[model samples]
Target chain A: MNAATLARTRGSLVGRPRGAGHVLETLAAWALALLWLLPLVYAFWTAFHPTEYSTHFSLSAPWTFDNIVHAWHAAPFARYFVNTVILVTMVLAAQLVLVTLAAYAFARYTFPGRDVAFALVLVQLMIMPDVLIVENYRTISALGLKDTILAIGLPYMASAFGIFLLRQTFKTVPRELDEAARVEGCTPLQTLWKVYVPLARPTYLAYALVSVSYHWNNFLWPLIVTNSVETRPVTVGLQVFSATDQGIDWAIITAATLLSVAPLLLAFLLFQRQFVQSFMRAGIR
Target chain B: MTRSREWLHAWLLLLPACVLLVLFTHFPAVANLWHSFYSTPKGARPARFIGLDNYRALVDDPIFWQALQNNALYALGTIPLSIALALLMAVWVNGRIRGKGFLRLAFFTPTVLPMIAVANIWLFFYTPEYGLIEQVTKGLGFASHNWLGSKSTALACLMVVAVWKEAGFFMIFYVAALQAMSPQLAEAAAIEGASRWYFFRRVTFPLLMPTTLFVLVNAIINAFRLVDHVVVMTRGGPDNATSLLLYYIYEIGFRFWDPAYAAALTMVLLVVLGAVAIAQFVFLERRTHYQ
Candidate 1:
C-alpha cells in the first residue's frame, strides 16, 4: 500500500481518537459505493445464471455460458468487436499524428495568425464534431463515404482536446532540448520527433487512453454514419441487439452487454490505477 | 535560418489538422447556422433559402418545446446531484475508510463502461415485473413500476441513469483535487478543536470551489452530450418524455430527414454550450484560491 493508505489504515485501526460518527460515515460511504456498483454487479450475476435464475436469484442456480454463447450467436458480435477495434485504432492513430504536429507548431513556431488559429481550434472543445452531426453527416454523404469505418473516424481525426493537451505538454518542454537537437543538425520536424515526442510520452499515453476509450464508446455519430455490420461499432451493435422487440430477457441481454464491454472492463480492471491516473493526469473533466 | 522558414514549417505542420478541423468542426458549426436558414430539400427539390421558417416551425413545434423542457429539467436534475454525490464519493474514498480500494473501484467502474452497454442492463433493472427494483417493490407488497415505460417517470428514470454514469467520473476529479489538499490544514483544524463538519464547511468546501466550478461546467455539458442511455432505454419513448435536445436533433436529422430543423435545433445547443464555455472562462479568471 502507499504511505497515505497505510496511514489511513493505521488511523482507522487506532479508533480511540475517532468516534461513532467516523464509523457511521464509513458505513454510509460503503453503502453508497455498493449502490453505485449494484447494476454492474447484477449484470455479472444475471449473465452467469440461467434464464430462469436470472430473476430468481437462487443460491443453487446452475452456472452456464449458454447465455454468452446465445448472445454471441444472436448478434454479429465478433464483427462488431473487430469494427470497434479498427475504429478506435484509426481515430487514435490519426489524432496522435495530427495533434502532435499541430501542437509542435503552436508550441515552437512564431507564426502569423497563430493565436487566431489556436482559438479556432479551441472552438471544437465546446462545439465538438458530435454536436455538428447533421452537417457532418451531409459532408460524409457528399464524399460517398457513408457506412464506412473511415467516415466514422474522420470527424474525430483532428481532435481539439488532443491538440490542446499536447500543446500544454509541449510548452513545458525546455527550449534547450530544441536548441540542442537543432545544433545536432536535426530539422524542426526531426527535432520534434527526436526530442519533443519522447519528452511528451506520458501526455501522449494519457491522451491515447482517453481517445481510445472515447471513440470506442462513441455511439451517435457512428450510429448515424454506419448502417451495415461491416462498420458498426460495439456500442451501436449492443444497442441494436438489446433494443430488439423480442421482449426483455435479462440473461441474454446482460450477456450481450458484458460481451460488448468485456475488453474495456478487463483493461480497466487490470490497469485500474493507470486508467484513473491517466484521466487525472490528462485533466479531462 | 530565416523567420520565413519558421513560419513556412509551422504552416506545413498545422495544415493537415487545420484542414480536418475546418472540414469537421469549424465548417460544420458555420454550416449548421447557414443551413438553419434554408429548407431541407425533398426528392427532386433543392434546398433554398427560407429565412426564419425553420425557427418559426421550431417555435410552433410542441415536441421541440417538450425536448427543450426535458433537456433543461435533465440538466437541473443531474448536475447538482451528481456533483454533490461525486464530492461525497471523493471525500469517502479519500478518507481513512476500510476497503478504500474496493470503494474506489466500485465508484469508478461506471465511468469506464460505455453508457450504451450499461443502459441495457439498466433496461432490465427498470423492467416491469421481474426487474431488480420491481422485485424489491413486489417483495415489499408494492406495485411494479414501469420506470422507463411510463411517461411521468421516464425522464426522471433517465436522469437517475445519467447521474449514476456521471458522478463517478466527476469523483475522479474531486479525488485528485482532494488528494492535492494539504493534510496540515486538517491537523491544524483538529488542534484548534474544530468540529469535522465545521472544518469541511469553512475550509474544505471553500478550497474545493475551483474544482467544483470545473466539474460543474463538465456536468452541464454532459447533461447535453450523454443521450446514449436514452436511446437504449427509452428511445425518447412514451411520447418523447425522455427526449433531450441532442436526441431530438438526432431524430429530426436522421430519422425524419429534416436537416434544416436539426440544424436549427443544433444552433440552440451550440449557443448553450458557447455560453457555458464563456461562463467557465470568466469563472476561472475570477476564481479565488486559498493555499
Candidate 2:
C-alpha cells in the first residue's frame, strides 16, 4: 500500500494515509462506465420522454407513451416481434440439435480428419455468415429460399460457435460415464442423447442464449435474404423504417429503435446473472 | 451385426450439420472463388469469363482502395480502444463490491441489444439540428458541428459508438479470467507490499493474457462484421466518409451489381480475417508452451 492508503488503514494522524490510488481508480472506472453508457442512457431517456422533447434533453419533461404509441400504430411491430421470436427459436432449436450431435461425435468418437474437420468447422468463426453474403445470398437463392423466414436463418443454423462451445463442454464430461453407458448396452447415439446432453446443460443454456442474442441482433444477412413484411425480422424492419430518401423523422426513428431493443433488453434484465455468466463460459471454452 | 451399423449410425448423427455446412459454407466459398472471374450477362445465355481482369480493375479502383484504408483505420482505432476499455471495466467489475452483477450487466447490456437499434438511437445523438450532441455543444456556446456529416469526424464518431457497444461484452471475458485467478497470489503480493496498481500490473495483467488474446480476436472480428450501425445510422454517408470494407462490399456487389469485382474485395477481407484467426491460434499455442 502507498503512504496515503497505509496512513488511512493505519490511522496515522500526522501523516494521514489515504487510499488515493484506490479512490482514483474506482472513480475513473465508474465515470468511464457512465460515460460509456451515455448513449444507452440517452436512448433510455429519449425512449421514455415524449416527442418534441426527443431532440432536447430536459430534466422535467412531460413523459408519455405517445412516442411508443405513435410508433406502435406506425408499423407492424407486433408482427415483427412475433417474427423475431420465431426466427430466434427456429435457429436456436436447429443449432442445439445439430451442434449436440456433431459435438458428441467429435468429443467421444475419433474418426478420420476429425481434428482437421473440427478445425475447418471453426473457419465459420473467422468468416462470418455475413462475410459470404455473395455466396450465402446465392446459396439461399439456389435453395429456393429467397425472401423467406428460413432463408434468413438457414445458413446460421449450423453454428460454428454452437458446435465449438458444446464440444468444449462435452470434453469436460468424465470418461467413466461414457464407459459405463457403453457397458450397459447404450449405443453411441443413445449414450450421447442420454448422458452427454444432460451433463452439458449449463453450456447448452450458454450457447443457446448467445445464439439467440446473436441472431436477434443479426441484420445484414437477414436484410439481404428477407424481402417483405411477412418474413422480416425486427432489425430489418427497424432499418426499413428510416431507410428512405425523404427527410427522416427523429421521433419515429427513435420510437422504432426503442421497439427493437425492448424485448432483448427485458430478457437481459430478467436473466442478468445467467446472461453475464453465459458470455464468460463462451469465452472461457 | 449391429456393431458395424453403430459406426454408420455415428456418421448418421453428424449428417445434418455436415450437410448444411458443406452446402452453405464450403460450397459457397468455392463458388465465390469461381464466380469472381465471371460477369452475368443480362440477356445473354451465360456469364462471360474474365480471369484476373476483375481483380486488375479492383487494384485501380480508388473507391475500393479508399474504403479499404478506412476499414484498416477503423480496425486499428476500435481494436485497442475497446480492448483497453474492456480490461479497465473488467478490473472494476472484478473488484469486491456490492452489485458487481448489476454493474457488469449494465456494461454488457449493449451486446445483447440490436446494434441497428442502438445505432438508430445514437444517430440522434450525432444528428446536426436539434440533436442531443448539438444541443449539448451549442449550449456550451461553441458553434455546433454535424458529428456524422464531416468526413474527418464521422468515422471516429462511429468508432466511439462501436467501442461503447463492444467493450463491456469483452470485459465479461476478462472478468471471468480475473475471477478464475487464484486469490492466494494477490494476497501474497499484498503481504509483500504490492499496491493495487502494482498487483494488477505485475500479477493480474500477465495472468489475463489468454483472455486478452481471445478478446482481441473477437473484437477484431466484431469490428469487421458490425456494419449494421453504418447501414442504419450513416449509410456510408458524407462522400462515403464512414464506408467500411463490408459496407463497401455490399455497395459494390449488391448495390452496383458487380459481384465479380465484389468477390475480389471479399477475397481480400477473407485474407485479413484468416490472418487474425491464425494469429489467435499462435497466441494460444505460445501460451500453452509457456505454461
Candidate 3:
C-alpha cells in the first residue's frame, strides 16, 4: 500500500480509542510547547510594554518602542551590529572557500597521509576553538590581531564541520560528471566549480545556515579576543551593558537582549522551514 | 594528469585549511600541554620550567575539583532529559497531532536565540520575588526564593536553560530520522496487534539508536563546550557552584592572568574530550556493523 493508506492504517490501529489518552497526550504536548515558549514570550512582553508591567504581566499594559530605542542608543549598538555582521560574513566567506577546497581535495583525490590529514581535520570537531580560548588569545595577541574583527573570525574560518559536510556531499556526486568536465578541458578547480559545487548546493546552503547561526550567536571567543566597542559583537556588548547596568531596568535589559537576537530571530521566522531543514541536514551527518 | 601532479594539486588545495586547522586547533592543543609545564611569566620574569607544578596545583585546587564536579553534574542533568524531550517532540511533530506546526515553532524557537541573550531573560525569570517563577509560585501560596542566587539552585537553574536551548536543536535531528523511517514498520506492528508503547519500545526505539548515539555524542561535547549560559547567567558564581571546566579555564587564563595554570586546567578538559572522541569512534564503528 501507499504511504498515506499505511499512515491511516497505522493511525487507526495505534490511536484506535482516540479518547482520554489521546487528549491527554495532546494537552501535554501543547503544554510543553507553551512552557518552552514562555521565556521568549515573556521577553517580548517585557520588551514591548512599559517597565512597570515587566513583572506585572498585565494584559492591558501600555506598549511602547521606548525600551528598544533607549537600548539602541544606550550603547554603540549600531557599531556592535556592524561588527557582528562583518564577523559572521567574514567567517562564513572564509569557511566556504577553505572548506570547499579542502573537501574537494579529500573527496576526489588520493594522496599520501590523506587519512592522517583527514583525521587531523576531524580532531577540531572534538577540541573546538571554543575550548582553546587561552592559547588562541595568546596567539591572536602574538600576531597583533587581537580585538579586531579578523581575530574574531580567524580561528573559526577553517570549520571541520563544513568540510566534513561538503566532503560527504561531494562524494555522492557521480565520477562521470568529473570525467565529463575534464574531457571538456575543464581544470580541477573548474570541474569542482561546475560539477561538484553545483550539485552540492543543498549542502552548501545547509552548512552556510548552520555556520551563520553559530557565529552569530557565538559569545566567549569574541568576548575574549575583543575588548573594544569597535570590535565587540552584540553578545559581548549586551553582556557588558547588562553587567554594568545590572538590575536597574529589566525593560532595557530585555530590550537589549531582544535587539541582539532580532535579526537572526526574524530570519528564522521568515525561513522557518528552511532553517529547520538545514539544521536537520547539517546534524544528520 | 599524472599521479604526482594530481598529488601536488590535492596538497595545494588542502594547504589553506590544513594550515589553519594546525595553527588554531592542533598547535594550540600541543602548546596547551607545553605551556602547562611552566610558570606564567611575570614582569621581567620569563616563564621557567616547573614540571608537574601546575598539575599538582590542579590536583590540590578546590575550585578545580568543584568545577569538574559541576561540569559532570551539568552533563548528567542536561543530556538525558533533553534527549528524551527531543525524541518526544520529534515523535509528536511527526505524528498527526493538531497544531503540530505551531508546536514545532514554539519548541524550535529557543534554538535560534543566543544563549547569552536568553540567559538575561531567564535571569529575570528567576528573580527573587517579582520574577515569573516567583509570581506563579506565590500565586500558588509558596514563599519567595532566589532561584539563581541560592548555591543549591544556581547550577540546576543553568542546566534548565541549557536543556531549553539544546532540546529543540536535537529534536530536528530526530525529526529528520523519524521522517526517513518507513511507515510500513508501524503498519506491520499494528497489524500484529502490538500496543503503541510496545512497538515504540521494541521497534521505534531500537531503530532510533543511531540518531540517539549521534545526538548523545553531540550533547556530551556541548556539555563541555557550552559556557555561554554559565558566563551570562552565573559567571560561575554562588560559590562556584555553576563553574564548568571551560569557564574555570577562562577565569584562570584571562581573569586571573595565569595562562600556565589555565593551560593545566585546559589539559583536563582536553582529556575529557579526547576520551569522548574515542568512545564515539568505537560506538560508530560498532554501529556500522548493524547497518
The candidate that achieves the highest lDDT relative to the unseen native structure:
3
What tens-digit string does per-residue lDDT give for candidate 1 at A102-176? 999998899999999999998888888878899999999999999999999999999888889999999999999
Clashing pairs in 2: A4-A17, A4-A18, A5-A18, A7-A17, A8-A17
Q: Which is the winner by TM-score between candidate 1 and candidate 2?
A: 1
Candidate 1's C-alpha runs over 4 A off are A1-17, A245-248, B288-291
| Tens digits of per-residue lDDT for model 3, B102-201 | 9999999999888899999999999888899999999999988888889999999999999999999999999999878776787677788888789889
- lDDT of every predicted structure (CA atoms): 0.88, 0.81, 0.92
Candidate 1, Cα interface RMSD: 3.0
Taking the tens digit of each residue's C-alpha lDDT, what string does model 2 give over B65-169? 888888889989999988988887887786643456667766888888888888887778887867777887888988979899899899998898888888888
Residue pairs in candidate 1 whose N, alpha carbon or C atoms collide under 3 angstroms: none
Best by DockQ: 3
User: What tens digits encode model 2's per-residue C-alpha lDDT throughout A1-285?
Assistant: 786565344322211114775567666766776776677777767767876677666788987777787777777888888888899999989889999998887777756667888887888888877898987887777779899888888888888888888888889899999899999999777888888989999998888888889989899988888888889998888888767624646666676787788888888899888888888888786
Q: Whose DockQ is higher: candidate 1's or candidate 3's?
A: 3
- Work out the TM-score per prediction: 0.96, 0.94, 0.98
Error of 1 at A30 (Å): 1.2
Candidate ordering by TM-score (highest first): 3, 1, 2
Native contacts retained by candidate 2: 0.59
